[model samples]
Target chain A: MNFPSKLIEDAVTEISRLPGIGKKTALRLALHLLKQNGAVTEALALALTRMREEINYCKTCHNISDHEECSICQSHRRDRSLVCVVEDIRDVLAIENTNQYQGLYHVLGGVISPIQGIGPEELKIESLLSRITEGEIREVILALSATMEGDTTSFYLSKRLKDSKVKVSTIARGIPVGGELEFTDEVTLGRSILTRINYSQD
Target chain B: MNFPSKLIEDAVTEISRLPGIGKKTALRLALHLLKQNGAVTEALALALTRMREEINYCKTCHNISDHEECSICQSHRRDRSLVCVVEDIRDVLAIENTNQYQGLYHVLGGVISPIQGIGPEELKIESLLSRITEGEIREVILALSATMEGDTTSFYLSKRLKDSKVKVSTIARGIPVGGELEFTDEVTLGRSILTRINYSQD
Candidate 1:
């Protein structure tokens, strides 16, 4: 589409570069920004630039942080011995929102995807191994996704940690809490059946 | 959702303010930005800020431009005697894309919507009237939408311009090309029949 101004065209082009946003949506967003106060744009620009330029990652967990170590990693209340390994900061946020886990996290940054040219060396696997070998950690929970990449990364990590004293486990996979058995995929159903827990006597 | 850092959270909040973007989508976008090269974020920030801060509007047409007078208004090829009135710059772009209209445009900025507290004085209608009264203009084509606000603005403009000698016309409304008559709505179908034109004998 022909734009009246080069500035608008440039803005649209940059905005559409983001995932899931198309040219039309970018144009709409640019126009929306024009309608708002100048301060809004200023704030948005500053926030994005500052985050991209100045944001740090936790030295211990490799999660995004404003300081040398992330808040979770620095917190004394968090169980440092129980580390949940995840793919990226987004997964960290998701698990943190659950409030079910009080342990620290080890963000792998990404999975070992050969198709994407991301190997074990590309992730924070070395740091994770070093952290485990430092010897206080009792359990290392593999909280990655159920995709092929996730499985590959988990298998690799387990093989690497076999000699270590840390007990390695994976997050349980099954039908979602509100999901129906009929709608569940066959593989998930079969796995759920095989890994069924015994009925509690309480 | 909880973010790992304040910068990420701020960026997410600002990005989510755009139309059609929610918190989850904003978070996803922010994380996507974080994963990309710093140059991408810098370029995006620069484009957005520059567009918002330095963009100009055409004085004559009120369409967005990089200069005081828009390219259409400054061009000698377009018909000076004909003016097509539209609701916004988007309509101007749409009409321009058709490559059929040779007339200049008068952007209303927005329609007269009392429900939204918008009135004639709030739009660029006064400048349009002055342009018309300055003489030599032969036709004023109302190319606004088919909505209630469009009709109201058109009616108000026509009534105000009744004393003028310029011929005022509206773009025809009918069943869209390739639209099935069976699926057509009653009001449009009824109007189309009432305003039916005769077949050419040639």
Candidate 2:
């Protein structure tokens, strides 16, 4: 069947691009947006506009931020000597929600997946090395997922930092198979974090 | 503890207002939009802006349109004699996907909901009656859900249209209990359309 109009079709196409959103969901979301008052729609548009105009990755921690340095990296209360390395900004948020970790973060952008054309160069591993070289980092927590790529990245990082005095560690992988840090319940993630172990022994 | 920033928090709050979107999901989507290049985010913003700036309810059928009348109403191939009444614009898209029906549509916006304060006056029932007064219309298909509100609206409409010579019908109740028409597979929705029943004795 034909679309009601090109604009409607375009909206469907745009909304479908969102993660986990399929064609039918996109159509519903588009129609829902269509029904809203101009102010609400404009608010979404303004948010999107602001995201484009203002957001940038913090040079220090690599978290999404509106400034040159993310709030997490700029905060004085955070322990700079304890850096948590994660795969993406989502992991940063997950860690922040725990409220128990007082350490700073270093986002790797993604795990090393050679099959998917993602290698060490594609990630921010170089930046991480420089940050640790500053000599203040006494501990580096690998908070990457429990996937194969996550394990490989942890092993690679542990090997690379072997000569350094920095104590490289990893969060426990007891969250069950196929579990994602993003979807894991907060309590479970918290427990896993509390039960962290040294990665060098593995 | 506090949101990354006030602007980020505000944007996430707004996104969370959407159906099925939680705080974490909202934050993820907001961050995703922020991470994209300016042009991609601008396109997303433009989609929202244009949807707000251009879309309005079709004066005749109450369906969302970029103009005074929707494309279906403007099309010459569609049967003006047959008007398919639906709960919302999403229903219109569902029917369109099947490529079966070639008639105009009337969006009621919602069904009769006593608790939600929705009634005949709240919807575009009077507008549907106004369209039928032209005498060219021969049939009216009630394509609403099988909820209590849907049943009430259908029964109310059948009674109201009994005096008119126009034929009244309802889409078959092939949809499962508590199931939304939006989630019903296209095949099931198509079968329901093929098995529609006459609501009036005539």
Candidate 3:
């Protein structure tokens, strides 16, 4: 770990602070930057700095955006009455890539994980409730992950919205597409069988 | 990946340009940055920019440094008559980590590789000879990698240095420390057998 220069040591230290990147990988990356054009390093630095300083969060849905409100929340083509709730902005992109849902989305930022010291108060639950109370939403889909924290957040949200007029539902849990029944996990297989839908010709 | 913000997209693109990182990993890193304090990203950007703009190459050995000469070349404790020739700064670092050598180093930048369009003129071979011709150096050790290009470069250098008074040698090639003989490669095993040294009490 003997660095030839303090500048390189500083760069390596900062880069290795990122998750999954170790010191050796950071040194390799720093050397690569040194080998490339100065403009490349300058551009990367400018991009990261600008991204950190200028990005905004949608005031309503809590997703990242270039403006005060995200494009999805501002779009007129989306069904405002049907809202799909997800854990973070990445989930919003994943669901959008599927092209299956046309409704607007509400990002919860993160689920309630007591082990991580994250509770419902730290999430965007209050804003989501406010959006639902605004009276245009008729259905709310809990699209969180299948982990314990996801289920806890979903249950909490369902209880909070029990008095509201909006019907609360959750995305179906089952073996993934292209998954074999023999290799599927027990809980998933049992749930898929219990919630099996009647077959029909498309 | 349908990033919600243009800033995030730009950051992801630049971060993904680094070796071993992909769009998904870039996005994950970008999100992790967004989740943390803004100062973290700013520090990384600043460090990279400073390193790229201010880092220098040693005028003598071509190793990276903050000054005109590297610490190794400036050290009076090292044997000026003995020199270890390596391909890059990383190789110099690797040898330094061993703590066995007490000589100076000369970095040739890279080995001769036709596939990479690198010739003798592209490296610091001429400088190395000039240093040797100055009459202070008595021995030169070639510590390049055990690869085809490394051998080609070594051969070319030996031909050029045959008329010089300095003794030429190469780092020994054998099975790696703690390596299992059952899984060792054939070429290394054969070479180790041919070049076996007599056992001695150290």
Candidate 4:
């Protein structure tokens, strides 16, 4: 589409470069910005630029942070020996929001995906191994998704930690808490049955 | 949703302020940016800031431009005696894309919407009238949308220009090209029948 101004064209071009945004959506967003107060654009541009330029990652867990180590990694109350391995910072935030896990996190940044040219080497696998070898970790829980990439990454990590004393495990997969069994996929149903837990006596 | 870092939180907050974007989508976009080369973020931020800070409006038609007068307003190829009144620059671009009309445009920025507290004084209606009064324009085509606000603006403009010598006309309303008559709404169908054009003869 033709733009009336060079500045608008440039802005739309840059905005539409994002993963999900298209040229039409970018144009709509640019026009929306043009209608708003100048302060809105100023804040948006400043936040994006500052985030990209000055953002930090936790040295230990590889999660995004404003300091050398993330708040989760630095907290003394967190169980240092129990590391919940995740695919990215979003996973860390999701688990944290639940307030159910007391352990620290090891963010792999991404899982192994051959089609995307991303392998274990491109992730924070080396740092995870080093952290495990340091000998404080007792259990390493792989909380990655159930996709092929997640399974491949989990398998590789388990094999690598086989020599170490740390007990490597994966998060349980089954129907969601509110999910009906009839609606559950066959693979998940079969797995849930095979790994069924016995009823605990009160 | 929670964010792992302050930088990520700030960026998500700012990005989500756009019309349709929500916090989750904003976080996804922010993380996508973090995974890309730093140059991408820099370019996006620079483009948005520069556009917002330096963009200009055409003095004559109020359409967005990089110059004092828009290209359409300054062009000798366009008919100076004909002006299509539109709501915004997007409308101008839409009409230009059609390639059917060969006249200039006058952007009102928005229509008269009392609920939104927008009135005729807030738009470029005064300048439009002055342009007509200049005695050069022979016709004023109302190319606004077919909405309540659009009709209100058109009505107000027609009443104001009743004493002027220039002819005032509105774009035709009818079933869209490729639109099925069965699916056409009652109002549009009725209007199309009432204002039906004669069959062309060789």
Residue range A156-193, candidate 1, lDDT tens digits: 99999999999999999988899999999999999999
Off by over 4 Å in 4: A181-183, A200-202, B200-202
Docking class of 2: acceptable
Question: DockQ for each of the predicted structures, in order?
Answer: 0.83, 0.46, 0.85, 0.82
Residues B1-202 of candidate 3 have per-residue lDDT tens digits of 7888999999999999999999989999999998899999999999999999999999888899999999999999999999999998788888999999999999998899999999999999999999998999999999988999999999999899999999999999999999999899999999999988889937
lDDT tens digits, residues B1-202, model 1?
7677899899999998999999889988888988899999999999999999999999998899999999999999999999999988788989999999998999988899999899999999889889988996899999989999999999999998888899999998899999999999999999999988789836
Candidate 2 vs candidate 3: which has greater lDDT?
Answer: 3
Higher-ranked by DockQ: 2 or 3? 3
For candidate 3 chain A, the 10 contiguous residues with the lowest summed lDDT are A193-202
TM-score sort, best first: 4, 3, 1, 2
Interface RMSD of each: 1.0, 2.2, 0.8, 0.9
Candidate 3: tens digits of C-alpha lDDT, residues A1-202: 8988999999999999999999989999998998889999999999999999998999989899999999999999999999999999889999999999999999898999999999999999989999988999999999999999999999999999999999999999998999999999999999999988779837
* Ranking according to lDDT, highest score first: 3, 4, 1, 2
Model 2, A1-202: lDDT tens per residue?
A: 3566567777777877778888788777777777677788788778767756765678888877768888888889988899999988778777888788999999888899999889999899888898888999999999988778998999999999898899998886557678888998887788778876669875
Docking class of 3: high
In candidate 1, position A174 carries an lDDT of 89
Q: Give candidate 2's error at residue B45 in angstroms.
A: 0.9
Taking the tens digit of each residue's C-alpha lDDT, what string does model 2 give over B74-167? 8999998999999987789889887889988999998999898887898889988888998989999988887788989999999989999999
TM-scores, all candidates, are 0.93, 0.82, 0.93, 0.94
